[model samples]
Target: GAGVSQSPSNKVTEKGKDVELRCDPISGHTALYWYRQSLGQGLEFLIYFQGNSAPDKSGLPSDRFSAERTGGSVSTLTIQRTQQEDSAVYLCASSRFLSQETQYFGPGTRLLVL
Candidate 1:
């Protein structure tokens, strides 16, 4: 199967707008994750979804950030009332079973909040 794919590879929005980023995981992958990387910073875990279990969203930076995975395959991350500090590369990754397994990552969506 194909690797993970994300829509809108690049986005530029106003400071007060909202944005939706989408991710399509590889087939049969039961674990998915979202991460953010700022300039000169390491990847920051944003959310995690595994099988039918509840998603671990503790990594979300604030109340305006949220995500959801459907059927254990596709996931979407939404950021409301974007700010300049929110500019970063949003990355999505998936694995066959668990977080400890080999994970495949997608080309991140670069978001620039003006």
Candidate 2:
């Protein structure tokens, strides 16, 4: 595959609504990650998945946020009960392995929770 691809590049939702963001990682990459970047802030790790094992979701900001990787290729992030402060660019990245190496990132999904 060329690179990671995210759907619905831009999303706008009313407060208290729910939304789902999708990511399609490059083929053969076994390590995937999700991150969020708020305006005027740095990227924050949200979750990570390695192979078929349980994802490392310690970085999720709250219980309202969740994600899942299906078949080790595509992943989706769901935000329940959205709030204005939840607006940010959700990013997805993937690497061949979970080692000290460079990771390729997607263009990111810009989410706006009004």
**Which regions of candidate 1 deviate over 4 angstroms?**
52-54
The digit string of per-residue lDDT tens for model 1 on 15-113 reads: 999999999989999988889999989999988889745456789999999888877778899999999999999999989988579989999999999
Error of 2 at 41 (Å): 1.4
Model 2 bad stretches (over 4 Å): none
Clashes per candidate (backbone, < 3 Å): 0, 0
What are the C-alpha RMSDs, in order, of all predicted structures?
1.2, 1.0
Candidate 2, residues 71-109: lDDT per residue as tens digits? 988999999999999999999999998888578999999
TM for candidate 2 is: 0.95
Q: Number of the top candidate by lDDT? A: 2
lDDT of 2 at 34: 90
Q: What is candidate 1's CA lDDT for residue 105?
A: 97
Scored against the true structure, residue 113 in model 2 reaches a CA lDDT of 87
In order, candidate lDDTs are 0.90, 0.91
